[model samples]
Target: MSRIEWERIGRERRRVSRWSGGTTAEIAIHPATSQYAARNFAWRVSTATVEAERTDFTPLDGFSRILMVLENELTLHHEGHGTYRLRPYEQNAFEGGWRTSSEGRATDFNLIYDSRLRARMSVLEVPGEAALVAAVGSLPCEEGEHWIHRIWYTAEGSVEAADAGGNALCRLDAGDALLFAVHRSHGEESWSLRNAASGRAVVIESVVFS
Candidate 1:
């Protein structure tokens, strides 16, 4: 974990906001003071619950968004783009400027980034009593541009994390997250995590390059 900076965001640290549609909690954002509402962020990761039966999405003209349903079914109607019916953990990537609306209620995870930067989002499921090894800096990149951050959000259950040397990191419960950031030339770094509760654990992993 040398040369890397990490943060643990527990429940108390979350900035939860209520919108017309539902509530959204900001997990992490690039540049400490950047505003999501003002659309001044380079990237942002958040989880939101859509409570209204039908809700319109805010049009973000210069961004790209990746949204994943964490619970229930969600039907997204993206104007000019085909409608997408997504189940739990299923994600849809589209331009932020699309005229998008949703039908049905759901709790979702999102990664919205400036279109000029490269980003990737995915869901990882860890079975009960199982351990998973995850790595950052493994994504393919060019010489000048490289992966700089890796974020893991625990969406379900709890997970105990440890570094490559087996040093304890922290336990991430539902809505908790671990973010690691690094710079310069690095080959790869890994983290080991184990599910500490019954049933499967769902983790949303988002990787970004500056």
Candidate 2:
């Protein structure tokens, strides 16, 4: 039988920080690698609150990166691609080799994956029942030889996900996340999500294809 392993990340787990660009970043998830020289990792997710008007992103080689604005607005300047403005919930993807810089203060969510793996990230707002269902329905399951892994982060209010028969799977608060794996052998699966708090909830979904 296919099963969903659930986990809840609270504020205490986000205690680790890495300093860069005059700010500290919270490392939410970092997959283990065998050696220090190993450039590739399974995946990594993190968040940072940029208090300064301008911040330089650390150069990451041999990886693909996605950044989403969790609050406020910011403009990203890619070495070759001109400046791109991002508002709340908006995201941009770039090759890790690019020299990227940003200006304006905002809380941001980031996903970085090895170049060999395929990855995608998106932000969904669950303001009503239909929107919540649509977001949950968009999660893809493993098929054939491919495997899919997903990470869900709550950016706004609290949210809860449940299995088809109404079994509570996971509940996430602002800054919390749930990561799970799906395999081809799991067969078809269905899940639903609802805004557990009083208002709308925003979710950031990061998926990896390996």
Q: Which candidate comes out best when scored by lDDT? A: 1
Pull out the clashing pairs in model 1.
Answer: none
Q: Listing every candidate in turn, what is its Cα RMSD in Å to the true structure after a full C-alpha superposition? A: 1.5, 3.1
Candidate 2: C-alpha RMSD to true structure equals: 3.1
Give lDDT for model 2: 0.73
Please name the candidate that would achieve the greatest TM-score relative to the true structure: 1
| Per-residue C-alpha lDDT of model 1 across residues 1-210, encoded as one tens digit per residue | 444678888867889999779999999998779999888998999989999999999899999999999999999999889999999989999999999999999999999999988888888888786689887556666566655777899998899888777778899998899998866466667878899898778889998888
TM-scores for all predictions: 0.94, 0.84
TM-score of decoy 1: 0.94
In candidate 2, position 78 carries an lDDT of: 96
* lDDT tens per residue, model 2, 18-117: 5565444444444543221365466788787887787777777888888888889989999887789999888898987888888998888888887777
Each candidate: how many clashes?
A: 0, 0
**C-alpha root-mean-square deviation, candidate 1:** 1.5
> Each model's C-alpha lDDT?
0.87, 0.73
